[model samples]
Target chain A: MERTPVLRSEWLKIRTLRSLPGALLALFAATVAFSALAGVSEASDPGFDPLFASLSGVIPGQIAAVSFGAMAVSSEFHQGALRLSLAAVPRRGRWFAAKAAVIAAPALLVGLGAALAALLAARAGLGRAAGGLSTGEQVRGVVGCGLYLMLMALFAAGIAALLRSGVATLSLLVPFILVVSFVIGDATGTLADFLPDKAGQLVLRETYDGTLGPWSGLAVTALWTAAALLAGAWRLCRRDA
Target chain B: MTSIDVRDLTKEFGGRRAVDRLTFRVHPGRVTGFLGPNGAGKSTTMRLVLGLDRPTAGSATIGGRPYPALREPLRHVGALLDAQAAHGSRTARDHLRVLAASNRIPDRRVDEVLQETGLASVARRRVRTYSLGMRQRLGIAAALLGDPEVVMLDEPSNGLDPEGIVWIRTLLRRLAGEGRTVLVSSHLMNETASFADHLVVLGRGRLLADTPVRDFIHARVRPRVRIRTTDPVALTSVLARHGHDAQEHADGHWTVDGARLDDIGRVACAAGLPLLELAAEEGTLEQAYFDLTGAETEFTAQHQEA
Candidate 1:
């Protein structure tokens, strides 16, 4: 079979995988649930930006995205899966490319839907405050948040493939996103804005004072993802199954 | 045709050689048993053949080309390196379908193999829920889904019941009888003796013997004529004068080689000795195998029993 069958098989692997699809579902649920909570909660500070508040659910939702990416590849590391996979598609490049595509496509689709859900749910709770957000900002925020989550997911997948362990990837990333990015991100000031998660999240805000602009920040995040993906491809090509 | 060939194939992990300059050819239309003790490079050699591991030196090819060169390798060879290598969460049917889809095998072939392997009843159940025997069947089902010309299995009989073992023994014979090359690896002597047409015996990453099973048994096993007599001392002296080395054990049985049972009985009769029992000990593949590999193995039958 040509590349089509490999891709189809990988798609089937992802779809049938209970944990991976479960992770995607968790992504949708977590993001929407958090955004709904953000909408209902009263903002204590005067610096409350409704746009950021509406999309705040992305903070927790992106964990599921990263998990999805990492788990998709990490599953191969368990139960001698890589051996069986390589037996079917002997060419390593073909198998790795197909796996990456399977991970990216679903993540992007679900990311968009989750982003839309977060905005709608959060907007309902912040009705009057969300009124001031322009149409262009909402569109940018939605599209950017979707793309941002997808990038984070792809980044995690590349890392997972290189390490061949989802546990390692999640352990490193989950804390970095939730803890290190805030505590260390504050201490580092402008330099911290270029970090993959930090830089990519810039578009989530309606107004930004970061060193990099929204598209440029996304470009930086994409560059990080590209670098990670190349490293993953290299590892996949060189390592034994 | 040499459907599966390993030419001076060598693999080393860190500083230790896992497979050392192994060379063998498995021809089509026969089942070659890959026999070895634990850690004797059986799995490593199979991995090299399938390109799951890079050989440190030399080459392993299937149908005359390295595995990576095949556009879709499954169409040429199907391998099951491990029975439980599959994800536990996927159903048996889904597992076969995933492999089938990768090879462009028809969806119907999935069901066919499931039925053939007797897994149709639990096709929808998760693989984790299946017993070890069921997993082996599922692995065999995946290997057969592509309808490949060559099937290579490692320890396929490990978890099988008597009926399942019989099923696989027949399946292997039928597969080879259909002109496909079937290479099965197992350490069990009697199990392979039942169905293997040829034997490739390995020990400590080296080939110990490679020949037709019957030929190996004939060449390595020593057939003996056992004699039990009332007057053992008289018979022993008579056999010794007849140029036969008859050794009498403490159990009062005399074993003699290089002569027929008739000749031994004639010698006893010539000595006016009454024989209580006279018989010939037939050589078995297990006996032959141990005689061939006893020194090369780290442990012996005594060790295994202990």
Candidate 2:
């Protein structure tokens, strides 16, 4: 039928689910809490950017965003929920699109709120130290961080669809985002910038020496999310529920 | 008008064929029992019909269109593949709401089904806390959210208590009485016999019999007469002479297969044998089903007599 009804149904599912909303709350808490901590601390490094530092909490907080996306899709795989979902919607593509849309909408909304709160919390501590920041730079950092978190959540969601297991998606992603992205960046300079997480996080920086611009970095991450989602949809159409 | 039509439907997993060229039609206004032993592909066939699984060959349709091709399919066919399919953390009300919203069904219908299934009292509780029977009621509620013309349930009575079983039986009968195409699958022949007017028997992923329930029983099982006599010796010898082999039971009653009650009475009267009781023994669905699928059972135990 019409896609609107299916999208509404998916939104209801997310609202009713405690864990899905809980993940968003955790995202907000982690981003604000970490950014506030960063704001209170003084960094001696000459290269530190105050705007980036204010939103740096997202580095760890993005994990919650990834979880929100993964768990939302993975719940369908548990206890034959996918069968019920498919039976209700029947059109596999329509149902999946609705699911992805619901995931992206909430992630982006919460990401934006978290980014704004973190910036405000951290700026309180930076005081004169953050005076060099312009309104445009601060706005970009906040907005970009929000979009960055949403992309990460969608990226995790796409991978979750392909694997059809939330735990597997989390296991692969949690470590890669936590360890490999950093280690690889230190070992291989520009190449690590191409990875989905590293590329997307570039938006949160006020100044960057990377080849990609803020929006272009986010675009690279979007491409990765799209590829993962395409793979997921292919598997959904090809495999029996 | 919405009937399930499955034609030459086939599904294979890996090298093993789960459903083999199965063909059957369940008409509106009747309860068609999809009967088979475990691993007989009853579930697989249902999955194919619902478009939950793709058919390796052939097609299944409802109202002249494939399941996925139908817009707002839940309003055309409501199915309960697994009673536990609802997410455990969501309340029963929310679970039905999700399905209702998907089909653009009114929210009032969700409460109606919950009340119909006697789950309204527990509608606010999380499904994880529900007993199996309660979960089954919730599943039924979800299925009826759209008030679809065709209702399909697989092994719905598995975890229900006797009262719950009776409830489902009445519900299925009422659904069929309302002219809906009702398809219910169960491994137990006797259970299906209670509510099913038509039988679609399957064995080893193949159609065994598709006929009226009464005809299915009468055509497969031999009609027999049970005779209780004061003089067993005389009755036996007389029937033996008349070309009827009488088998004696432990209950002191003699049974003569392929013999009518009237024929037995005549022989007893002509021979002047005292007949305490002479009646046609009722053929049970269990016996008829066993006779039909006995050979098709995947794992058959040695006969008790053997």
Candidate 3:
């Protein structure tokens, strides 16, 4: 069958889900709120990077992003919905690709809008401290923040598919992004730069002193997302719905 | 028109075969009841036919093509594997809408099915709030959304009221009347007898009987004679001497298998026994089904022990 109708069906599923839109709303609000707070309080720190601080609200907001991805895939596993979906489409690969496309598009759009709002909100508090940021730095931070959030959402979605349980995906990811990346990140030194969350966040930094540059950091995160998605696709195809 | 053809289909889970080289064809313009006991693999066979699970051996096709090979499969074959398969958070209308959109079916067909299934009033309600019978209606609405040539439902009459059951029976007959192939699965023989024209019976992952409903009963059912006499001992002796398989009931009635009512009465008259009552008993579809599946179960048990 042609792919357009299947994609349209998937898009309808996402839009009709009340919790999904709520999660996106939470993503936007959390990102903007936390960035404003970081700008006000963290601006006094001697080592503060203005670009990173302005976009730092994504640190907390990305939780909602992860949830959006995980829930979208997990709902299909609930109540034998996957059986109905596959029966209608019959081609598991095509249905899965359509699902991925719907998830990616919404996450990317909302992530970009949220990042731009966070940067402006935080810059309001940073005042003179944020003045050192050049236009190029600000643009990179905004764009990188959006892409980073979208990647994290996809990363969570892929893991959810692999695990076949949204609760498990959230349980594994929320902790890894919150505790491992934040607490163990410093102790691991350069190794932490390759972790999905840390690597992606590096793109938001104005200047980095690591083996990876900004774009390469996002590329590493993309690699992690790709691996997770591949594993999910394999499991979906191999198992009986 | 699409017809389901399953050839040597086998499915094994963890070394235990669920469907053992089962083969059957469901033709159009009639209701084919997929009959089996629990775990007899009726659902598994349906899943294989729909390409939901890969068969361990052989193939299942619809209209000369595998299920996955069909473009817009919903328009080719519509199936309801589980009544509760839809997401609870979505409204019944949206559930059907999602399925219709997948096959490029017209949006109005969704409303038509809901109306046909008598769920138009509750179409906007979330499925979580629906009763089991209501959920069944929603499932049926989904199956009919594309107006497909082939429709398959598994245990669809479960949790339905008597009226709902009758509704499904009429719906199945109407679909078959339209020259569409319909396959419905259930463990209850009497229920299937009410609506199905042909039956495909399974026992212990194996095919037990495949024939028309009337022929199934005629072939599997054994007619017997129920006799009551004034002198029990003399009549029993006479019946025993005549080589009849007669068993005494708790209510003082004797049922003689493989015996004619007239012959039993004549023999009793010649033996000088006064017959109080003598009548022929006709076997029903329920009894016939029990006889076939019950014997198969015993044979399977002994075969396994061997």
Candidate 4:
């Protein structure tokens, strides 16, 4: 069978699911809300990068994006949904590809909208402090921030497919992003640049002192996402529904 | 119409074989009852046939092609492995719409199936709110959406009300009458026996008997004759003297074992006994099933614990 119908079917699944749409709404609200709050706070340090400060809301906003990706695949495991889905499409690879596409599209779109909104809301509160930022830097930060959020969502989707449970995926990912990354990064500086969350966020910074450049940092995160996706595909094809 | 051919199919899960080297053929124009006790591997065999699980050995094919190899599998064969296989949060219509969309089926087909399965009124409700019977009806609707030539359902009568059961029986008969292949797996032997023309019986993951429903009963279960005569006392004494085991009922009926209708008629005529009623009876499929599975237990020492 042609793949177009399968992709459309997967898109319908995401659209019809309450949690997925709710997650996207939360991603927009949390990112914009937190960034605006940060914009009102005083700049505590001399080395604060205005661009990174304005985009910092993504730290919390990314939780919603990852939740969307994880929930999309995890729902299939519940109540034998995967069996029905596979019965309709049969070929595991085609089904997985269609499912991954649905996750990527929404995550990317919501990520862009949230990233742009966060930048504007923060810039409004920062006043003159944000004025010194170059136009090219702001543009790069917005675009990179959007791509970074999408990558995290895709990464969570991959894990969800492999684990076949939303709770398990969220349990592992949320703690690693919130606690492990900060604790490990604070303990060691150079190694933090290669971590997926830390490396990808480097693009949001106006001035960086990390070993990886903005684009190169995204490359590291992209590689991690690719690895997770490939592993998920392998698991999905090899296992019985 | 299509045919199902399962040859030496086997599957092992955690070192225990769920489906043994089972072989059977289901042809069009009849409802083939796939009957077995609980844990007899009926569902596992169905799963293997649908390509939902990779068999450890051998193969199962529909129309001479593996299920996954078909260009449009649902158009050729529609299967319902589990009734709870749908996402609970979506409306019944949306569930079928998305499934129909995947196979490139039209929206009208979804509405048609809903109407056919008596789910049209509840199509807009979330599956979570639907009863188990409603879920079962939705599953049947999905199976019939493509108007497939081959239909496989694992216990379609489960969770259905008496009316729903009767509806499915009529539907299966209608599909078979159209020269379509229908394989229905159920542990309800008598229920299946009523609608199915053919039977493919399994016991402990092995083929027990494969024959027509009537033939299976007559072949596996011994024939019996019930005789009611004007002089029951005389007939009982005569039968005992003739070395025949006969059980007497208070209503002047004697049940004779291993006696043909012709033999009884011959004896009654020679004895000049007036017969009020003489009828030959066969055991039901339910009894035959127990005999077959009971016999299997004597030969096989191991079976699935699940």
**Top TM-score: which candidate number?**
3
- The residue pairs that clash in candidate 4, if any, are none
Using lDDT as the measure, name the better of candidate 1 and candidate 2: 2
Of 1 and 2, the candidate ahead on DockQ is 2
Point out where model 2 deviates above 4 Å: B224-283, B299-306
- Evaluate model 4: give its lDDT: 0.89
**Which docking category, incorrect, acceptable, medium or high, applies to candidate 1?**
medium
On DockQ, the leading prediction is 3
lDDT against the true structure, each candidate: 0.88, 0.91, 0.89, 0.89
Sliding window of 10 residues with minimal summed lDDT for model 1 chain A: A182-191
**Chain A alone, model 4, TM-score?**
0.97
Per-residue lDDT tens digits for candidate 3, residues A101-143, read 9988888888899889989988889899888888988888888
lDDT score, residue B71, model 3?
88
Comparison by DockQ, 1 against 4, better one: 1
lDDT per residue for candidate 2 within B1-306, as digits (tens), equals 889999999889997888889888999999999999998999999999989999999999998899998888888898888988899999999999998998999889998999999998999999999998898888888878889999999988989999999999999999999999999999999999899999999998999999999898778777789999999989989999999999999889989998888888889899999888889996676988988898888767677972
TM-score of 4: 0.91
Please state the CAPRI-style docking class of candidate 4: medium
DockQ of 2: 0.81
**How does candidate 3 fare on TM-score?**
0.96
